[model samples]
Target: MHISHTSEDDNLKRLLSFSAIAIKSSCGEFDIYGEKDTDVRGKELVFERTRYVYNDALEYFEDNFLSQITSLGISLIPESDEDATI
Candidate 1:
């Protein structure tokens, strides 16, 4: 799945963007932005990290979001064969 977030706060935006990309990659899926010209099947999940503004958004996502999604039986596709060169 693809995940992303944006905020007026630069730090939060950066953190969320980084965390989203990391989470998606770790789950074996490429970041959405990286697949601009390709067709893929997956849901784009957005989180309101601003709610946990003071805490580490990355940690919260790992502890809360990742596990929850995994439990739901969603499978992350490994890097495509074409990406093997990279």
Candidate 2:
């Protein structure tokens, strides 16, 4: 079936995308990291410390995971400035 989303629906959809990123990252499907240091760094990838966060992690999701979906010519319109903040 075909369905269309209004502006309100679009905003909600984008906001809800955070949960998807969280779940996939937590499950080791989408890695929120780039490089890793060991021994001198205790050999681990930690969040916001040994690893990255916020924009870095968000960028990882967009480039690795989200890009694949959105690249299929899907109409994933950005809701608004408010949606961009999240």
Candidate 3:
């Protein structure tokens, strides 16, 4: 049996929400929707460090991925920011 489209949509939505939360949390943003805001008080410094690490890692991966593809001689058409949102 195959997964249903509804389930796929729900999973995608949840993943996107999780990514948003991770980005915010890494940047020391208050989690108004959860108890982490109070529970992690005084830990924003650590989260601030995490933000740099995450950005560095993301940049590394993007650069590595692009280099791998370009080295294979496959030309990539650049997409506009809106088209690349997902």
TM-score of predicted model 3? 0.27
Residue pairs with clashing backbones, model 3: none
Q: Per-residue error at 75 for model 2, in Å? A: 32
What is the Cα-based lDDT of residue 84 in candidate 3?
73
Candidate 1, which segments miss by more than 4 Å at Cα? Answer: 1-8, 30-54, 57-61, 71-73, 78-86
The prediction achieving the highest TM-score against the true structure is: 1
**Cα deviation of 70, candidate 2, in Å:** 28
Prediction 1 TM-score vs. true: 0.39
Model 3 lDDT tens row, 25-82:
4333444344543324323323433343444554443244444323222222224543
Report the C-alpha lDDT of model 1 over 1-86, residue by residue, as the tens digit.
12375444686567567645544554545444554322122223324333343354535645665554463223453446437757
Query: Would you list the clashing residue pairs of candidate 1?
Result: none
The order by descending lDDT is 1, 3, 2
Pick the lDDT winner: 1
Please provide TM-scores, in order, for all candidate models, with all chains considered together. 0.39, 0.24, 0.27
Query: Each candidate: what lDDT?
Result: 0.45, 0.36, 0.40
Error of model 3, residue 3, in angstroms: 13
How far is 62's C-alpha from truth in model 1 (Å)?
Answer: 3.0
